[model samples]
Target: MIWNIYLIILTYFLLGGIGFYLINRKKDPLVARKSYTKFIVYFFIVNGLFFSITIEPVVFRYLAMVITGVGMVELIRLFKISGYSRKSFFATSVVIFILLALGFCFFATLNKNLILFTFLVLSIFDAFSQITGQLWGKKKILPHISPNKTLGGLVGGACVALASALLLRKLLGVSPVSLLFLSAGIILFAFLGDVAASYYKRKYEVKNFNDLIPGHGGFLDRFDSLIAGGAWVALYSQLADI
Candidate 1:
């Protein structure tokens, strides 16, 4: 079990390195350095969270709380940087959203399989989205929000996620139909989550979340997709258990 996870982590980084290198090959040297640095930080954080949630599932709740607190701080900082007063509606809405995500994280801890499912999709879907998008994307998906986002990337990401699920069906011990449905959910929710995060950043005129992870913006920036996707995954996992 542990070795399987280690391999997943290794695969994530290997693909990530290739994708980032490909995308940033022509960009400034600073970009590549930052990408590699943030990759290292991301590697450790992901490993830490995975071990806690899998080996010691009980710790997931506490870690979820930590994630929540960190996100709140990062959001506050982002608001300040935007030089805007905190709107009550925006604050309330976001607080509710974040809390809802935490609820999913807590619930997922009850089953190791569910927990693994959440993280695996997040990792695979995200990396391929960028890699495929850069290589074949031509039309923008959400040009108004994130100019970099492309329809081709979205399709590519979803396809890769679904294909990856074929292999996961064995480990998850589910029928192909069920796994495909789950993959579809991951693709939809994860992309929406990422878009939601991008929306906020664009609204605030902030480049990244908070620069917590060097190349990757702030903590919220990295976990934005997880926050949203977790909410959706929680429902799916619950239904799967039924």
Candidate 2:
């Protein structure tokens, strides 16, 4: 299992690196640099996630809590920086934090294989979406909300993600029908989660939630899809009794 994961990560990084390099080679040096930085940051995030899930369950639980706590802090800071009154959102913020924390904790408790499968799908979707969008994306899906999101990117990402999911069907030891549903759920929710986060950023008029991450906006920005996608998976697991 461990070897499979290691191979997956290595292969993904190699493929992603080639795509990024090809796409960014002709761009402005600064823009290309930023894109590479984002890739490196994503690499670390994936590794961190792998570590969290592979560690002791008790420790993973606490790590999830800590990451969620930081995300909440970042959320609050975003509001404050945007000139929003904290008191107005105090109650709502608290509830969101609680739910997010619980979501992460829930993720920590999921089967390791399931967790890896989820991450792998998201990674494929995210990488291919951005790469394809930048390369060939012509139709903007939500120009007002997120100009970078394109129909081309969406289709490309979903296709690649779904293909990867189908290829790795053995990861979850589930029926083909179940795997299909799970992949669709992850892709749909992950995309929605990203759009939802973008909606807030548009409202906030902030480029990023914070500058904690070099290329990725912040903790919340980086993990928004994971939180939402994981929540969907958790709910699906219960409903499907997986």
lDDT of 2 at 20: 94
Model 2 segments more than 4 A misplaced: 55-59, 85-101
State candidate 1's TM-score.
0.86
Candidate 2: residue 211 Cα off by (Å): 0.8
Best by lDDT: 2
User: What digit string (tens of lDDT, one per residue) describes model 1 on residues 130-161?
Assistant: 77898789999789888888988888887877
- Would you list the clashing residue pairs of candidate 2? none
The C-alpha lDDT values of all candidates are: 0.74, 0.81
> Candidate 1 at residue 92, lDDT?
72
Q: Candidate 1's error at 222, in angstroms?
A: 0.3
Candidate 2 local lDDT, 1-242, one digit each (tens):
66686787789789889989999999999999999999998898888777766655556667667767787787777777766654555557557656756765697688877877887898889888888888789999999998999999999999989988988888888988899889999999889878877876777787688888889978778877777787788788779877
